[model samples]
Target: MSLAADLGIAFGRVAFVMLFVLNMGGLLTWVERKQSAIMQDRIGANRASILGLRLFGLFHPLADAIKMLTKEDFRPARADRVLFGLAPFVSVFFALTAFASIPFGDTLRVGGREIPLQAVTLNVGVLYVFAMLSLGVYGVMMAGWSSGNNFALLGGQRAAALMITAEVAIGASIMGVIMVYGSLNMMDIVRGQGALLWGWLPAWGIVTQPLAFVLFLTAGIAATKRIPFDMPEGESEIIGYFVEYSGMKFGMFAMADFLETVVIAGMTTSLFLGGWQVPYLDAAGVRLPWGWTWALPHLLVVLLQVGAFVLKVCAVIFFMMLIRWTLPRFRYDQAMRLGWLGLFPLSIANIVLTGLVLLLWGGRP
Candidate 1:
């Protein structure tokens, strides 16, 4: 492609990722409220409305934006002003940028041109995501340390410890995936998943590497600082890292959390759920392993693939929200034990076992 075309593609991908992540984040806020309300037998977020049409609390996010925006921007008088102000932006920026390497669909061919559906096809996309996630910790640490509050500093310490611990399992689990797929490229992994196992089952990561999937999902939730592992922002007791923050700064932190959830969901879908892969469907038509074939329009095929990817992401997000609402928070000691003693070893063993099986079977990469 020409330089101009490359630039245009880059811009388009960036715009698409931003809008997708933000929209998912907004929708998840509503999902959290509605799901919790349903689980607790209560009405949820139904008061926000426009023109007397509530749309089942669909307007709540907008109302929240207005409320937060209109609130006073508060900061502690003795706090580190620069770091406190910079913290939430750091959180939000990393959350947004981390989704760039995850592929939402396989590819699209329009007219005479073929375009990949991901933002950027980095050779080490998996590593890139890990790097971004690791860097995200700085935001929380800064928020807590800059606040000059003992409680906030404690929360920051917990966050750093939890992330560092969980990341070991997360990295190990993904290493299994990299070994199975035999590539660090996200697109290649997604394409590899398009194959069929035993001429019937779709060769998704969940099927081939179920243990890694579980470990990765668990560690991913911990990395995002969600339920069962949310000691960092234990709002009920321990003051959170952003406890002293208010107004849009606090909103930014909230937004970053939701966006991080979406990113995790997307990554889970892409890595384990056969991203953009509709069974028996390809760019041209449906082709089954049993010698069956059916032609489909190119546009229809593209729609099917994209729809499958989106549906998988939404399903994973729903499951994650359910987990957040249903699971009890882990004690700090228990969380640490699970991360270091439980998940880490399992992830490592999973890698070794996967390698042995692949070696014995001489599996094709």
Candidate 2:
């Protein structure tokens, strides 16, 4: 392919990822309200509508956008103008960029060329995503410290501490997966998961590294800083990091949180689930364990893979939202303790166990 074509493909992938994430993040706002309402046995977000058409509260996100856009943008009298203004953008930017490395489908072969379905392909994609996610804390710190509010500063400190605890546990937890897959590339790891164990069971990360999956999901939830791990924004007690933000600025912060949740779900899908890999399905066709072989077109196979990825991601998001409504918020001290004294050591132990199992099995999974 020519350089121009390559660049075009890259841009197309980027556009696809951006649109998918942004739409999902926006839709999640409605999902949260509706799902919570179902759990609590109440109507939620049905008030927003146009021309008497509610569309089952789907219009609420649009209503929210209008409200945020029309509301007055406020800044503290003693705030640092530049950093305070830039913080929300930083948070949203990193959250969006982190998804670039996640592969939603296998390569699409078209007209003598193969195109990857990911926005960006990198050998160290996992580390790249981790770095991007870790950098998001800077935005939180900036928002808090520049707000000129002691409460905000305390929230920022809590966020920083929680981030440290979560990141460490996350890093340690994924080491077992890295050992199992023997790859740092996200695509490579997902491809590795396509292998079948004992001619039947798919060799997914959750199958081989169940412990890592649990550890990673726990730490990933903490990384997103949602319910049960929302120490940075304990609205009932402390107003938390972006307390001084208002209008669209506050909306951006909120959007960043949802984007982070989507990223976590995507990462979990790529790492622990099978990403876009469908069981008994390969590039050519479906190969059943019981001696049945069904051939499928390449385009159809690609579509199936992509569809499976989307479904997996949505399922993970639903589970996350379920947890959000089912669990109460964690106290700061309790969250910190869970992160450090609980998850961290357990993650380390999981790594050691994985290494031993890999060694005993001749590094095969």
For each candidate, give its TM-score against the true structure. Answer: 0.97, 0.98
Instruction: Encode model 2's per-residue lDDT on 1-365: one tens digit a residue.
Output: 58888888889999999999999999999999999999999988798879999899999999999999999999999999999999999999999999999999999998888998999999999999999999999999999999999989989999989988899998999898888899999999999999999989999999998988998898899988899888799756768999999999999989998999999999999999989999999999999999899999999999999999999999999999999888999888899899999999999999889878887888665
What C-alpha RMSD separates each model from the true structure?
Answer: 1.4, 1.1
Which ranges of candidate 1 are over 4 A from the true structure? 1-6
At residue 110, what lDDT does model 2 achieve?
87
lDDT of each: 0.89, 0.93
| lDDT over C-alpha atoms for residue 124 of model 2 | 96
Top candidate when judged by TM-score against the true structure: 2
Q: Which stretch of 10 consecutive residues in model 1 shows the poorest summed lDDT?
A: 106-115
